[model samples]
Target: MWEMAPPKGSRLFQTLGRRPVLRAGYAVVIGVLVLSVVEAYRIQVSLSGQHEEIYRRYVDEEEHINTLRRNLWQAGNFVRDFFIRSTPEQAQTLRSQLQTLQAEDADVLQHLAQMSPPSPVPPGVVKSLREFWAVLDPVPITMLHASNEEQYDFIQREIVPRRGELYAAMLDLSDADKQRLRDYDRQFAESNGRAAERLLAMLGLGVLLSLVVAAFSLRHAETLEQQADRHYAEVEEAKRELQQLSGRLLEIEEEGRRRLSRELHDEIGQTLALLQIQISNALAALQGQPSGPREQLERARSLAERTVQTIRNISVLLRPALLDDLGLVPALQFQLEDFQRRSGIACEFVEESVADYLPDPVKTCIYRVVQEALHNCEKHSGSSNVRVTVRQRPGSLEAEVADNGCGFQLNAKGMPDQSRGLGLLGIRERVALAGGSLEIDSSPGRGTRIALRLPLEAQPQPAPRVAAEVPA
Candidate 1:
C-alpha cells in the first residue's frame, strides 16, 4: 500500500528543504506571470501610440499632397482658358489664384516639416513643389502682354510640363508614405511576436520548476503518512496483546480466589468447630459444680463459634458457593441483598427466565459487570438507589445495572474516563471475550446505566479442575 522510501542518509532533494523549494517555485512562477503581464501591457501601449502617430502622419501627408495636385490642375485649366480668349480679366484672376495656391502649399509643407519622426514627405518632393511654383509665378503676367499664339506657346512649354511634374511628384509622395506605414506595421508585428515567444518560454520554465517542487512535497507527505500508519499498526498490535494477557490474568485470579476460599472454609472452619466442641464437652463435664471454670468454657465456646462464622463469611465473599451450586440467579440475588445490607442503598434485582445452564464465562462476566457497577455506585455515584435487571431471550441474555446518582461525564468517545475506566474496561474486556456487548450511559446530573448482552450460544472455555466440597 506504499512506495518504498529512500535509503538512510539519502535526502529527497540534494539542496534546500521542501518549504524553501516550494517557496522559490511559487516566487518564480508569480514573477514570470507578473513580468509577462507587464510586457504585454507595454507592447499594447506602444502599438497604440505608434499606430495613432503613423495613422495621423499618413492622413496629413495624403491631405497635403492631394491639395497640391488640385491646385496645380486648376492653374493648368486657367492657363488654357487664357490662351483661348486672351482676356485681361481671366489673366488677373489666374494670377491671384496662383498666388493663393502657392501660399497654401507653403503652409502645408511647413506643417509637414514640424511633424514627428519618419518624415512623411520625401526630401525632394518638397523641393520640387517650391521650384514648380517658382517657374509658374510669372505665367499669368506674361499672358496679359503676349499675343494669343505666343501665349499658347509659353503655356504649353512652361506651365504644362511643370504642372505634370508636380502632379506626378504628389502621387509619388502618397505612395511612399503608404509604403512607410506598411513597413512600420510589419516591424511592430515582428516585435510583438518575439515578445510573446520570450514570455511563453519564461512561463514554461516556471511551470517546470513548480512541478518539481510539487513532486518533492508530495513524496515527503507520503513518507510521513506511511510512518504514521506503521506506528498505528504497532500500537494496535500491542493493545491486542495486552488485552489477551489481561484476560488470562483475570482467569488465574478467579481460580486462585476459589482455591483459597475452599482452603479457608474446609481447613479453618473444621479447626474452629473442633475447638467449639471441646469447650462444650468441658462445660458439660463441669455442670452442677461451683468454681468449675464453666463460665470461661462458655466464653471460649462463644468466641470459637463467632470465629467460625467470620471465616465462613470470608469464604463466601472470596468465591460464592451458590454460584456453582444454585446457578446464576440465586448467586446474583444473594449478592444484591448483601450489597443493600452493607451500603444502606436500596437495590432492586429483576430477573426473567434466566436459565441454569448458562456458560460459566458468561455467568462470571455478568456477575463481574454487576459487581463492578455496584462498586462504582458505592464509591463514586453518590446514589441512594440502585437497580439491576437480567433477562433471557431465545438466543441471548441481557443485563443492566443502573443508579439514580450524580453521574459523571463521559469522555469524547462516550466511554468512561481513563481515571475511572479500569473497572469498566475490565467489564468490557470480559464481555468481549465472552462474545457479548456492553453499553454505558451517563451524564453529569442524570444517572448512570451499564447494560450488557451475551449470546446464548456456548462459548469455548478453559477446562475446569475437580475440587472437593466444603464441609458443613
Candidate 2:
C-alpha cells in the first residue's frame, strides 16, 4: 500500500502539497478511513467474544449432562442383571459392577460445580442419582434369595422408574442446548445486520481507492502475462521441433535397415548360393574317386546352407521385407512365428481383412509396435501364451498384442523400467510419425497388453505419408 503512493519528490505529490484544496481533501479522506477501520474492529471483537462465551458454556453443560445419563443407565443395568441371574454365583459380578458405577456417577456430578455458569441439568438430577444408587447398593444380596416372579416385581417397581427419570433429565439438557444455539443464531443475525450497514458505507470509500489501485495492478499484470505467453510459445515450439527431429531420425534408421536387408538378400545371399553350388558340383565330380575329398565337399555345402539361413534371419530382424513387399498382416504373422520358434512361448495371431490400400508408414508403425511388444514379453514377461489381434475401424486401424505373463510395474513416469522405456520410446516415435497412438497396460502378475491405433485415409493411399510428430 505504501509502495502505491507517489514518492516525495514526484510532480503529483509536489503539486498536491502546493494546492490547499487538494491537500485538505486528501487528509480528510485518509482520516475518515482510519476511523472506520478502528470502529469495525471493535464491533467484530465484541461479537466474537459473545459467540465464544455462549459456545463454551453450552458445550461444557452438554458434556457434564451426557456423562451423568450414561453412568446412571449403566448402574441400573448392573442392578437389573443382579435380579436376572437364578444362581447366587452370577450375583457377585453384578455387586462389583454397581459399586464401580456409583464411583463414576459421583465423579460425573462433581464437574457441574466446575462449570462457569452452572450446568443446564437441574441439581435435583444429581440428588436423584445418589438416592437411586443408595437404594440399589444392597439389592444384589436380596436378589440371590428372590424367586424369578419377585425379581420381575422389583425391576418393574424400582429399576425402570429411576432410569426413566435420569433419561428425562438428559432430554431437558438437550432441549437447553438447542435453545442456546437458537439464541446465538438470533443474536448473530442482529449483530451482522448492523455490521453490514457500517461496512457498506466504509466499503464505498474503499472501492474508490481500490479502483485506482486496480488500474496500476492490471497494467502490471498484463505486462507480465505478455512475457509469459511469449516464453510459453517459445518452449512449445522447441518441443515440437525436437519431436519432428526425432521422427526424422527414426525414418532415417528404418531406411538404413531396408537398404541393409536388401543388400544381404541380393549381394551376400546370391554369393553364398553360388558357393554352395560349386561345393555340390565338386562333391559329385569326385564321387567315384577318394571318399575323403567328397565328404569334405559335402560338409562345406552343408555349412554354406546354414550360414545362408542365419543371414536371412538377421535381415528379417533388421527390417522385414514383407512389410514393404506385402502388407502389415503377413509381416506380423512371420514375426510371431519367428518369436515362437526362438522362445518356446505360444503365439496366436488374429486378423480382420484390413484395407491393402494403407500407407507404408502406417503399416511399418503397426508392425514395429507389435514386434517390440512381443520382444518385451519374451525378454521380461514369463508368459506361456501371447495373442496378437489387428482389426480395422471406420477411420482407423487398431492392433493389440497381449500376453498372460508375470507383467511389470510402471514407474513414476508411467513407463516400464528404464530398459523397457528405451524400447517403447522408439515405437512411440515411429507411431507419432505415422499419426498413430500407443497404449501399454501392465502391472505385477496380471500380464501386459500393448494397443496401437492408426488413422487411415478415406481412399487408398499409394504413396506413404509422414504425420505431424508429437512427444510420448
Per-residue lDDT tens digits of candidate 1, residues 1-472? 9989764323634455666766776787788778778877887887789778778878888887788789889877866776776677877877888889889988887877787763567777677778777877777676577887787688788877787877887887888888988998898788778877877887787778777667766876886799899999999899888878887887888888788888888899888999899998888889898864877888899999999999988987788878877778788888888888889999887877677767777788888888889988999989998989888776788999999999988888668778988888778888887779888899998999999999988434323323222111
How far residue 65's Cα lies from its native spot in candidate 2, in Å, is 61
What are the per-model C-alpha RMSD values against the true structure?
Answer: 6.2, 26.5
What C-alpha lDDT values do all the predictions have? 0.80, 0.78
Stretches of model 1 off by over 4 angstroms after superposition: 1-57, 63-104, 110-116, 139-157, 285-306, 344-346, 379-385, 404-412, 415-435, 443-446, 459-472
Give each model a TM-score: 0.77, 0.54
lDDT, candidate 2, 217-284, per-residue tens: 56446756998999999999998898888878878888999999999988998899999999988887
User: Model 1, residue 56: displacement in angstroms?
Assistant: 4.4
* lDDT of residue 206 for candidate 2: 65
